[model samples]
Target: MTILQVGALPVRKSRGGFEILLISSRETGRWVIPKGWPSKRLSDPDAAAREAKQEAGVTGKISRVPVGSYRYRKKTVEHIRVLTVTCYVLWVKKERKRWREQDQRTRVWFSQEDAVKKVREPGLKILIASLEVRPKS
Candidate 1:
């Protein structure tokens, strides 16, 4: 069975433009959005929001609907599994000084262009690119 995950693309509007929050992957040390397995009680978007809080120490307004979905291979103890992650856009409202995974990961804010270059997943890059064209609400 395919594993499902939810991710949050945390963004904030700035004078220069939009900025996105990225966290370093625990194993790979590569920049990525806050993501995790689906929660038993929370909706997908809510799960994504929870992940952002735990992983990136971010509090934000999350979109109810997913912006996109991406498939990737995740390594397990025995083998690899294809995982599908639903991505949600979160407009950051507050950032805490500490979080659950803060010691395990580094969180940084980057410009959309810089963030696109930092993320390794092609599908995620495309999602970030699309954000540039989306009309501000």
Candidate 2:
């Protein structure tokens, strides 16, 4: 069975353009977006927002609709499990100086093209590349 996860594609408008935020994985230190299993009390987008806050140290407005989904294999003690993560675009409002996983993960902002190159997952790269950024009014 595939496990479901929620993710936040944290973004902010820069002088040149929009930038995407990526965090290092706790175990492998690989670049990845903030993601976690679904929360019973929160909706998918809300859960994604929570993950972003804990992992990336950013809080923002999350889209009600999902941006996309990606499949990845997660390594566990017993075996590898396939997980499908639903992603939501978060228009970053605030970045905290400290967060829950601050010590475990490093967060970095990159241009859309750079973010696509930084992530390992093919699907995630496509999502980042295809994201449409509207000018902040």
Task: Report the number of the highest-lDDT candidate.
Answer: 2
List candidate 1 stretches off by more than 4 Å.
132-137
lDDT of 1 at 115: 91
C-alpha TM-scores of all predictions: 0.92, 0.96
lDDT of 1 by residue, 1-137 (tens): 97889999999886677899999999999999999989889999999999999999999789998989888788889999988889999999899997899899999899888999999888888888788524256
Error of 2 at 98 (Å): 0.8
What are the per-model C-alpha RMSD values against the true structure?
Answer: 1.8, 0.9
Model 1 Cα shift for residue 16 (angstroms): 3.4
Q: Which residue runs does candidate 2 get wrong by more than 4 Å?
A: none
Worst 10 residues of 1 by lDDT: 128-137
- Residues 36-113 of candidate 2 have per-residue lDDT tens digits of 989999999999999999999999899999989998888999999989999999999999999999999999999999
**Candidate 2 CA-lDDT value:** 0.93
- Model 2, position 40, has a per-residue lDDT of 92
